[model samples]
Target: MNTSASDPVTDAPTKAAPIIEAQGIDKLYESFQALYDIDLQVMDGEFVALVGPSGCGKTSLLKILAGFEQPSRGSLEIQGKSVVGLPPSQRPTRMVFQKLALFPHKTVRDNIAFPLKLAQVSRAEQDARVAEMMDLMHLPSAYATRYPAQLSGGEQQRVALARSMVSRPSVLLLDEPLSALDVKLKKVLQTEIKHLHRTIGTSFVHVTHDLEEAMMLADRICVMRHGRILQNGSPTDIYYRPADAFIAGFIGETNLIPVQMDGAAFDNPALRCADPTLDEAQFSPGHAGTSGLLMIRPELIVMRTEAPDAAEVDCVMEGSVEEFFIKGSSIQYRIAVEGLREPMIVDVQGTATPPATVAQKVWLSFQRRDLYLLGEG
Candidate 1:
């Protein structure tokens, strides 16, 4: 478990001092509880995305981190200093909101300089810092005189980010800053934000409901539910080894077929789980009868007109292509395999030749090693 920047893979935490730490954090609004006992640690220069359904406490946590709202209980620290009672202005953090919140009347330079001014930095220093931040955002120097109303959405977004970065805060908090943009623009900024994070190397705690956005930007992901932290780990861990069926369904597209113990091995009537990778070690007594899901990613299944020998493939099932739609570079298939109530999705490259058409028989073969057994669906 490497916890330092020198490690090639940071699937585990880094050894650096946490840039932000929360212990036993809770939030309550009179009789209503907005957060449960939450403990989190964000390492210096790491990008952590807080994601969940609406009203799931992601935003509440971010607000607490920025000092806009105090936690109902527990302690928080930034740079190892307790900030339980600190005001937003006094904290070593900055928040960029979905609305961008650039001053309508202020020019780009002034908007970016406002935070430095509040800190009472010298005018010369403020100008130098703003110029440096603008360069980091790749905003042209010529745009300094333009107001928010004159710049495009991407430009305004960069300006808002510039303002946040100019302060050189220990951590940056984002509240769905790109949620309002069109899909194309949102994707473009997602890449830019991730790139900027690497260039600036600041701890970013982004709050969003968009799973793709979280996957695109974060070094680590914290999944929340009902005001509680449900899971936290690397993207691969979260996707390939989800803690539960709900997490699997929410994180990406997949076919979660019900499975049960058929004698010593797990079995799904609709699909087969005969891969050698699975055995007694993978099952528990409680899951003997029927309480698991055979998680198969669409991309993991190979579509074939002729079935492979059972001994050669992990799991094999016959199905007919009931429907399909072009999805960018891949074709998404809705296959009605034997015994499954709902159709399963099989994703294949768009260039697949002699493609399977509606009502066409096809074989869905997936490696047993690729099958993930999820507990009690």
Candidate 2:
């Protein structure tokens, strides 16, 4: 893998100082190890999301980096200065909690102006800045006087966002900022947030368990599990080239097929595909007794009622359709292949494509290059 400077998508082009860096971060609660040697860096003006299931330590790591929680071990630096002893309020980073944490007593303008007030900006300057922030967030100036309880959920979200951005913090930590909104509102907010980030260019470290949201918003994603980062990369890299079975399964829908390698070709009882593109003689002699899994995405599998006209690999699999799900953009077919414990999933696009109903026999095939090889669990 050419993971060098030439690969600008994954590799850093220059040694610019990371806006925030956490190294060897270890946190423990009595006997329970919360975080283990966690290492992460956020480039200046980058939008990064920490994503995982519940209790993945994403929130804990964010707190530690924001100076809200002290680490048991390791160091955190901002612009090359160690900030171990700094208090959360003193840190250049600010956090927007899931609750929005707005003061119900204060009006939208007052809430946004609170940060400027603490910073001791002049009264005239504070008013001017508040107006500018409200405009930037697309919040109406008339809504400034309304309290949190008076505004709609979406409006209140804008208020909270305006408050956070008003300070112009070097870094912003968002903890599931859009989780409270309805699906439609969440989507609108997602686009708004993306546009806001582009305009501000401030470093954003967003934490969420929503995979699609993370994929859409993050310049890079940090996938965490059991308090450790399992993988970190752009959405395409993480989705198409998952490092292990856990990552492969977590990122998206996949069909994990057990396989054994004979020379350079993958041999499987279920997979009858042939690849003329790969050199069969150059296969690596994998570790003995170590099983392998072939990861194939649902979309990569082609379903045909009959035979294909193209001279493709005849890796045909005959299975009875167990279920068919009508996803808005695509249809998902679950096939119960004989001798397999799990049903094979295949995604077909377009409404014009013939639907494969339950109990119908179908053939599936795909190219070898599209199949990812990984160590079996």
Candidate 3:
């Protein structure tokens, strides 16, 4: 289910209390406001991703959470205790930066043990903990004596993670830690990070602009825009049931067909629904008697040589293929429908033979239940 006004999405039967909570948080840099009334909660062991375009205040929010920047106006809590002005060192959190900020001159072991040494932990305990972290991060024992420059990018990332995690903080804040890596390494580290979170059971609050990364790594995603959160929910909810047109167009390519809402049905001559009588529930909330967009994902649209069985599908439209793209796993087709201004996108699984050629007349059909109504706003 979609969350309401920044409320945390509760997907489990037994909910865990939040390990980090920010209520009505706002931030300002002199005359420019950077964040709005933001409410967020990270449950124990939950992975939450703050995602948006650059300059959307996600990093500002992350800094606030990490105690690097104080919220201009708001209440901040950690594990049920107020911590608005607490310093980063005093807070029960650690941050892994995008640059993987490992000390160039220090060996891996010394880097991992730095926090413990700062806390005046005994030499024996420091050694034990650093050794344990090295093993946990899958770093070789031999690499402990090597400097940051001696390790590969992925290995250096592991060292940075180990350093942040060695102190056993309650929450781990990641600020685009995987953004600099190549695609293959990013995917490998993504899996490793997910596995590490599951293994350690620590709360992770990751900030990133990559929607695909957020969807893959996070238990819940908060999509932000222009210093405010637009929607926050599970990946499936955000993908299929976006709040508005901007959000529907954010994550991936989608077809948004304009239609006027007439009571319980869409009043568009160009569109056809299998069920003439549509329930009010089929429409988006607060959009009756007004213009709206019908959202259809590219992969959900089916291409047919002949007319589809009207009883089996809810919506059907005839269009001619204007362009086609050969994606490795799927073929993407741009079809020009008479009533729509832009070409409709459809993704079909790759096959030995193409489904339809350019300029070929094709019928696009999709089920009603798969469709979502979205407001233009």
Candidate 4:
């Protein structure tokens, strides 16, 4: 799996210094600890996403970065300077909240120019900067005189992003800014935000619970749970090489078959590995015990009417289709394999010939190269 965070332009390892350095950070609400020893770094011009369920300390960490809430412990530096005690206004980062916090009464131009105005920039400079930002955001000059209530949700989002970028901060923090938009508009703005980031080359630290959104937009994804960072790596690493089963299930639809590994072979009676000489590198590191999970992506498992040849595939299982869902571009099946409590999921392309039906016996096969071993923890 590719673990390195690559630069968006060159697709190579990023050599830029971290624009935001947060080490051993912790946040507490009196006796209740909201965050643990959280250490994160946002590389210059990199986009990182903080993703987890609610109450996972993602928002707390963002608040600490924005200086809205002080950390109970640890150090934070932006551009190599400490910003722990600084106010939000004094910090060099701009945040676009979930609600967008756009001034409803103000015109688009005034809303985008608010940051510049607060910085005491000259009016002429503010106008020029606002105009540049509007052009960059693809907002026409005619819309500049309109209020937020008059503009569409997507347009309001663009205005919020423009306001955040008007000051040209080294890092732009987004707190689920697209959560409220509809699916279609959210996708549109997601593309626009990605393009804007590429165009401006500003570091972005976006916090969201949407895994798909994170995978789509972030260069590196940080998975958090119980106020701690569970995993941090490139999207490929997180998807194909998840650290644990929780992350595996969180990323997408998958099948995690419990297996006992005895040396280089699985001892589970329900599983059959055609290849006896499977490499140990296929297993996750630190899996000391004889137990682990065999992770197979839904799309990787092929449903066959006849048993596949042992030489053709590494693993094979016999199961009957318990249920199925037609997902437009793909067909998802729940296969009931004996000795397993949950049904195994398999996804076939919508274009594939002859979809499987419920109660039909099918052979599920996947190659060793496509299988990933995850620690049972």
Candidate 5:
């Protein structure tokens, strides 16, 4: 089908020097390979996220970069210097963990100043840096003497961030720092982290299993699968133009309908109700095949009681609304078809004119570009 990935932000196509670069990276545990030929680059001042399910090697890759673990084979460089064998403290990077790892007995000022102490900075410098970090994190200086246990979760997070940044590392490593918080707190921290990244002007390598968090925090995302990078791109690229079937399913709720491909054109009895205005012959013969999925996002599906204006839309399909759900700002309709085992989910604005009701016939319309052709796995 016609390629239709939304370009949310057009960043530089290349950089003079990457902040961190890993080449032919591999990690093995006893004979089990955890990562294979992992090559990636983090540009200066960019936020890159490593995302995948459990045991997907995202954590391993992060550890390798942070010097907590060494790659079995590869070259790693930070700020144009090779850091393959350097310790975490020696490398130009810092890590923030999920548990915060803040000393419960230590006050906020002491916690943030811990890094300065390790570097043997003068006490005057330490106090000055600590105050600056607290100010940057928006933590009141009055709370400087309070212990981490006395602060709220968000406050404690700010302290953890302050500790990590006080060292002035060029690269900051975050291992699911926000995953432990509740949804609301997580969202607040997400914005705070992004703002902090911008203000600090440092490259950030964040690791998380939460896809939405990565989408919110990362300028670029590396999707891993079974110890391999599956796709790497902007959020728009990953969501709208997924590289393959697995990414399409993993990134969001999608409806995969089986369709028959006739040469470069899609042909199936199910497509008969589609509007003629759609660019039907969008696919090429080289990638033509019957064992493929017509991938459509639920939000893109428009349900109506009457046929949509053919000229104003693309394709339209006939189905019956079998189930209905009221989301906060959107309504979900489960439309049933003759051959499909499960219903197709169609999402529409909650305030749409004459919404669909359960057990009612409805039409689903969407653009031709919205029709993503993915090979069935």
Candidate 6:
């Protein structure tokens, strides 16, 4: 719950020791390259998430860091020590895979105690640690005797987390750990994972395709694409100021309109704004004829009836409501503007009052600052 905006570890002048570091990491599978010079760093006790599509090499990079596979080029260091040749067990890292990997016959207590037994901890010590881990994971003491088959999917995941943490490794790598659980169970486990990180104070490198999960739990998110890091920042940063079109569209719902920057305004007679100087930052002096993308979030745009006689600062665009969908807490509208090729999506909270029907004439408007500029298609 230490939610200060400024970083607490590094006082000022000096940089803090990174819990995990990977530089110029490369992985190749004969002809195709799975990873290419991927560089990343995780601070002590930070929860960092790696997110991307299926073939984005997220798993390969994580495996490389875990010592499951050595990188073809580059280096990896954990807790300031080079672990290139070290075995997974020797490195101060524990990985919890998608499959909880719990032994079906073993009881919860026995499962959590497995790591301790492998390390040759005394019987009494192992029992004590197992009890502590179960308590930390909020599992009932009576459930310790029950087998994995008797536990729910979430319970199994908790057991996996407990097992991984039993050794008190400096870093924990979670690879899509909640993908198998149902929606409700996934949401619950997400919170549990966040809480677990707070209590344990271990650096967590979580890999997932779920953007919302990454946004909610991660202190920083590293967005990957085609085996490379595209953008790395906090959730707010990624959502508000996406570094590229790929990230802007991937992290959340966005309408990337193809437009040209003419002077300070986005040109398209149909989508012209009140203030022509609105999107001036999108264009450079020498880049006049270049095409650019206007990144607009659905939530930032509002639907208004009749023209307002207010200041000449607001940007307005005319579009006809093509269709609408009722989400739990909001309504989504798909509107087709006059000149735009694709329909613009607008999201409004609490079921847009007197919602528009199909082919209804409507005006979509948004502020200047809300628009983000990105490279053209």
Give the TM-scores of the predictions, in the order they appear: 0.91, 0.91, 0.92, 0.93, 0.90, 0.92
Structure candidate 1, residue pairs in collision: 3-13, 3-14, 3-15
Candidate closest to the true structure, highest lDDT: 4
Candidate 5 colliding pairs = none
Per-residue CA lDDT of candidate 6, range 55-133, in tens?
A: 9999999998889988999989998889998889898999999988899989999999998999999999998899999
Candidate 4: lDDT over CA atoms? 0.90
lDDT of 6 at 25: 95
Q: Give stretches of model 5 more than 4 Å off.
A: 1-14, 273-290, 351-354
Give the alpha carbon lDDT tens digit for every residue of 1-377 in model 5. 64444445863343358999999999999989999999999998999999888999998999999999999999999999999989898899999998888998888999999989988999999999999999998899999999988999999999999999998999999998987789898888888899999898999999998888888889999999999998899987787777777888888778877777654456546655343222533332223455567778999877779977877666777889898888868888899977776688888887744387778888888877777677766
Model 3 Cα shift for residue 182 (angstroms): 0.8
Q: How should the candidates be ordered by TM-score, best one leading?
A: 4, 3, 6, 1, 2, 5
In model 4, the runs with Cα more than 4 Å from the true position are 1-15, 276-278, 352-354
List candidate 6 stretches off by more than 4 Å: 1-13, 278-289, 310-313, 352-354
Q: Which scores higher on lDDT, 3 or 4?
A: 4
lDDT of 3: 0.89
Error of 4 at 178 (Å): 0.8
Rate residue 178 of model 4 by lDDT.
Answer: 95
Ten-residue segment with the worst summed lDDT in candidate 5?
276-285
Lowest lDDT 10-mer window, candidate 6?
Answer: 279-288
Highest TM-score among the candidates is held by which one? Answer: 4
Model 4 TM-score?
0.93
| Global fold similarity of model 5 (TM-score) | 0.90
Tens digits of per-residue lDDT for model 3 on 241-289?
A: 8877788898778999888766656656767886744555556563544
Cα lDDT of all candidates, in order? 0.86, 0.84, 0.89, 0.90, 0.84, 0.86
